[model samples]
Target: MRLFPRAGPTASMVSATSIVVSGGIAVRGIGLLKLIYAAHVFGTSDAQDAFLEAFLLPSLLSDVLAAAVAPALIPALIRASTEGRTAGAVALYRAAFGAGLATTLVAALVLGLFFPFALPVLASGFGKEKSALTLRLLLVMLPLLPLTACNVLWRCILNAGNRFVLAALAPVATPLASLAVLYFGAARWGIQALAIGAVAGSAVEGILLAQGVYRLGYPLIPKLKGALNRLGPVLQQFGTILLSSVLFGCIPLIDNAMAAGLATGSLSVFGFGTKLATVILSLGPASIATGALPQLSRLAVVGDWRVMRGSLLHFGKLILLVTVPIVAVLMLFSGQLVRVVFQKGAFSTQAAYEVALVQRYSLLQVPLAVISALGFRLASSMAANELVIPAAGVGVAVAALADYQLRRILGVQGIALASVVTQLSVIATLGFLLKRRMSKQRLGVHTEAVPPGGDAL
Candidate 1:
């Protein structure tokens, strides 16, 4: 087998991974620009803190749910395709599209209605005006979660067909839209421009993805009839994965909320640093996982553990190859990177130094974070999400204690340290589960069963 396959599924794997990575860099570039622009505009101010938390709520919810639910749909998709029936796969897509669309809207509505109360928990340090602003901003951005959910589901359909380019590049729309808003409207509209940009951009991406899915012969309309029953196992797996997503997803909210009480600008500084660090750390692993999942799931379906293990190692190596040097640079010149990347307009010298420290602290977890991401993706391919919920629970429990203790001693950097600790705890738990799971990778296959006399989407 070629290390870099040129034909066959492995080749598609390599090709897709390549598109996702190269495309991811471009997308992240635009995202970094938005961060830089926002930093220039808001700096380490109360307003910036409020904006970050408000915006963050939607982003975290979108990613945690979108990323989890989409992959859960993948194995079932691949199984249906493997059985040589596009109708079965298309039905799964319909149920997923409708269910995701409806579920996220309900969630968004609940959160929007309660944001006034939730704002205190989301950012406890905010005073009356800041909380008021956050509530307003959040209402505008609340739709982002549902928009993102629908978009990712569309991407899921496209990717299931081995067509990934639109999805890979679609994210560019959000940041680009945000940047245009900031550049053109920030003077007049303030941070509200960013909120508008986020929703608008996601809607645009949805349009693009919808067209792609339609071009591939899938209907544009969502069908929820018999969705729960049709989505039996996928629905079951989604619940388990969503539970894990929520467990892990709440950490950032808590971390930022904790930072809010420390100092006027502590939350902003920590948010800035972590955003920069996480974007860097996750880029390689995220792309590799997205590109490789279908291939991994296919291999696991055939019980080819040996080649599956090889693919895992190769993918892991690819991550390290991209990350090690980046990590070294981040550690060594973090201060300079912070300065060059963000220190501008309102972002002061002191703020840059503090952010640099947080970056270094967050960097320590990169290796294990990378490993854990790969482990989780591999488990997802094998439909072993049950293990993830417990692992995430352990991590969240550890985060609560670690954040409480570390923040008392170290301030915002302590929260960064807490993240490293949390990742360590989660990876340890996952390692144990994967060891047991590997033995049953073949026999333990769990996918949505094609219902008898059904799949009439």
Candidate 2:
């Protein structure tokens, strides 16, 4: 709620925030353009809905696995590299890559095989034709799980080394490739082109990111044998991170599934609205979290709780300053914004109105979601990841109950409202837990100023 901290902003905080926000602006800008293109080409059709459904599993799996691995790995990698444990960092990277690859491949194979059975349950309201289309698209996109897993790991490797530019920019390839395909080929190939473009884009992103990591001298090899043993700390934290990620990730999945049972294009509308809100998230909270985590990790490792707390408060204020106004503007002009960005070609006026309503409700969660993300990053840095599990459980439970009660009353808009409510609940819980934990520790009692060279953290 406060825009300025008592101690003012530190150079390190500004530098970290600047790096991430600059790159994130590019990433989210390209991503927004891609969504605009998608809306133009696909609108809110059943085909679009089917494609959205098809993408749900792979995206969820990729995100969950990436989220689990990256948080645990980045902090460990930071610690290892800072301690001059190059060999240890390399082994950790390799082990994480190996484990992530194995898990992704196994998931893809198993899901592909059983998708026929699972599709009905996931999209219980889909007609036979739409269900078949979704299945085909899903099978084609299964490879993305592994590709995304590798890409995410590569980015983590880069981020740990403070190579933020390449790590942040590599993902731009996805939207870029997707945009090209949709612009040139959407008319010729239809929604299938969207799927094809997604797979291709993922491949490009993964390859380029992996190459970036390789150029930095870390090979993307699966050296699981000794690597796993070497990365035991990361592995130890992995389970808790994985559980939290899966729980948080399921909120979107649950929303999409619930949307599937609604009107034909409800899922697509929700997807579009959420994607727009996520741009705000990417530009601020997500970028800040990614940039801040390594530094926080270093601080936590050296028992610098006072500085860590200041850093947390500084980042929180930064998020509040950026997000509060953006949310206000978005809520005010949700209709006009949707119309200007997406109401064209295949997208209609009615569709824009529906999506604008969803976007308005969804945007309410942006600030809270940003704060919650910062909390998670801080918790992870301190290896207090287990704290996130109960928080995520609470968020997901509240979201589910809210969705169940509200969707019936408000239709698709209810789902978006539920997300905002869920995030508010989670942030309150996590903030209380983190504050209690910080207060119990002895490190915050002193008022010593951080060293002049604190910028390097």
Candidate 3:
């Protein structure tokens, strides 16, 4: 019913949250290191853009698919586990894997085929040489499409079984592989090494995750018929989720596409600007919010308005208190942070200034994102998924329109501002819908026809 936890606790809550956040930071640190290394090698060149753009697409597509797939698949797995020694659950896992394999292949095939035709128009700002390089890197990296899609599938399956350690650490493969490439091959192979490493790292992640799932006893052996037969219920749950996932995930792509039409290095600037915000969210509030979900769900189930509102407010305040100062420091030291993190190699003084400017704007997302994370968990605990879908759609629309209007006057900084605008609108809308839903007092414990394992988290 709710977002997610460690024994519904205070000290344990902190412990659980700390572990989640710290682990995320540790894992992501490797990837961030890879990026820093790449920055040194590539700077804001066509090569870097080509690597980022090449990498961004399949990654984005896989993430969008994973976002919707995991949540929808969870409910189905829980239901299946109630059947017979998780026999149905295992069957469903196989089915999901099979279907994911089939579908991701089809999607990748279509994308690979259409990319050449579509690239000229979508990335019209790309010159002949730049576009050609992006195409090469993308094709080399495309096989990861299946690797990534499968990684998402297995990761969700493992999480459903309460096996998260591997899921968390497994992602390190991507960055680790990339780092190796950047270190050993950057001079010889240039960005092609980056592309190759990405595909290889994803493959490693896929292997490790598949192993974990099998050890958990859900081997994803391929079976088309099984997948087709079991697809109905999952598909039914998938439609709304797909829309929200697409909308929410589109913001970066929107920025990238819009930035493609701008000056040569805009894509990297936009990415670098937003990088610290990502670190802040993952290292702090997002982790707490995720680990803190189960407690909020408990309170929601009790349906005590005073307790619910008070607990929610307190948690939100605590999250903000911990983060706001960090946000302030980051804003103040944006330039210094950029210099320390990415100013070496081909990166220059002027590029750092421009990146810092955008970073100041993008850093605003930290507080807004945490608030939204907590709010979304609250909505989930209240079973208000319906409210979130349209809110996300509205956010995506706002992002596109704002980026267009702002990019003209403000350039890349305007694009960063547009993201902030989207978050503000979505959160405001979600807050309103959540308030109305809470007023209905419809969040009481569900004793009627409870599912076999009860509501997860």
Candidate 4:
């Protein structure tokens, strides 16, 4: 069909939404394959530990940069396009893209410089050979940061333009392409080849999504307009988003590091558990959100609070239906799942037990996980006083305090438990804020619907 959402029957919306969400599942599936491959190929050795450890910072950076740019781009672009202000809309897109690129470059440079010293502090027990390999791999991954940042901007622009299928499918190309590299190039060139392939995939994905955005009439020009006064609010909002995104992204990384500190193999176990948790909790919910965000922003832009509220509730119910079974299955069969999936070859039976234990703890947050995700995105779209920062701040505080308390008592398992606790606390806070927003939306609807009773202007 077409790239943009169109006026059609109810079936059309269902079909389109399914296509987008299915495309996300496809990409996520390939990503899972890549993860399993990496874990298998790298084994549970110290080199693998150091490699995963070194990847934490870069992965976190990639997430924060993308998160910072995406929410603003979506709402801003949707507003510009809906108002038919083509020039203003295109300018905003360009500005957001440029901002993401610049921010990522600066972060990479600073992080790369400090990575060597930081590695020792985090994983001092790791052997010197593995540490050196990790440091080198990290430096290579640094460039991927800017590429990933640019890709996220383009992907957000595409989604804002109602090209959800294209945006969702864009990620699949990277993993599929990397699967090729992982199988062939990795054997010949080693981890460096795998790193190169990843960067290449990022570049390709960015270009494809950027082209899709252009075709959909969102300009990719790198020009800026308007006064500093206008730019100030946008930048301020992004700063909060960036901070929140960094913390949201860093929690798993921090948990993994703490686990590794407790024991060498803990990082691998934590990584495997996280991948499984994200597959259940993050991937599907993210897909639905990606499809719905443009429509949600459209409703918000015109002050149609009833439709916006309905949208949130509809998606919330879906998340609940999907997550409950996942949490149940995970908790009931964590050991069996780990053993079946990762207990072959070098991964070992002992490794399976550790990962299963972590999975059991991590699975507790499943239901609230879905709720908090919707709450965060809904708050970001509302953009009133920019709520993402406060919500994210609560998460960071919870994670820090819980990590300190639990890491001492339970070791690796304690870190996972702390994560569950932090996630629940954030969900509680986000639930309150979402309720307040809904209340205001309801009041506004009643106020608008009532007659004026002969009041003077």
> For each candidate, what TM-score against the reference?
0.92, 0.91, 0.87, 0.86
Per-residue lDDT tens digits of candidate 3, residues 230-308?
A: 7676765566668777878888888888988898898888888787787786666546544554444344335443554
Q: Which ten residues in a row have the lowest lDDT in candidate 1?
A: 448-457
Off by over 4 Å in 4: 1-17, 218-221, 224-233, 377-387, 432-457
Candidate 2 lDDT, 125-188, residue by residue in tens:
8999999999988988898988888888898888878788888777878878878887888879
Q: List model 4 lDDT by residue over 132-158, tens digit each.
A: 988888887788888887788788777
Q: Candidate 2 regions off by >4 Å?
A: 1-10, 381-383, 442-457
User: What's the C-alpha lDDT at position 330 in model 3?
Assistant: 81
lDDT of 4: 0.69
Over 1-457, each residue of candidate 1 has an lDDT whose tens digit, in order, gives: 5556566555656678888877788888998999889889888887787788788878888878766766678768887888788998888889888888898999899888887877877677789998998888889998898888888888877777788888888888989998998899999999899888888889888898889989998998889899998988776666677787888887777787788878899988898888766786556656666787777657655656566666667667766777778888878988888999898999989999999999889887887778888777666544466778888889988988998899999988999999989998998898899777666654665333222211100
Better of 2 and 3 by TM-score: 2
RMSD of each: 3.7, 4.2, 4.1, 6.0
On lDDT, who's better, 3 or 4? 3
Q: Which stretches of candidate 1 lie over 4 Å from their true place?
A: 1-12, 378-383, 436-457
Question: Per-residue lDDT for 162 in model 3?
Answer: 54
lDDT of 1 at 255: 83
Cα error, candidate 3, residue 27 (Å):
2.0
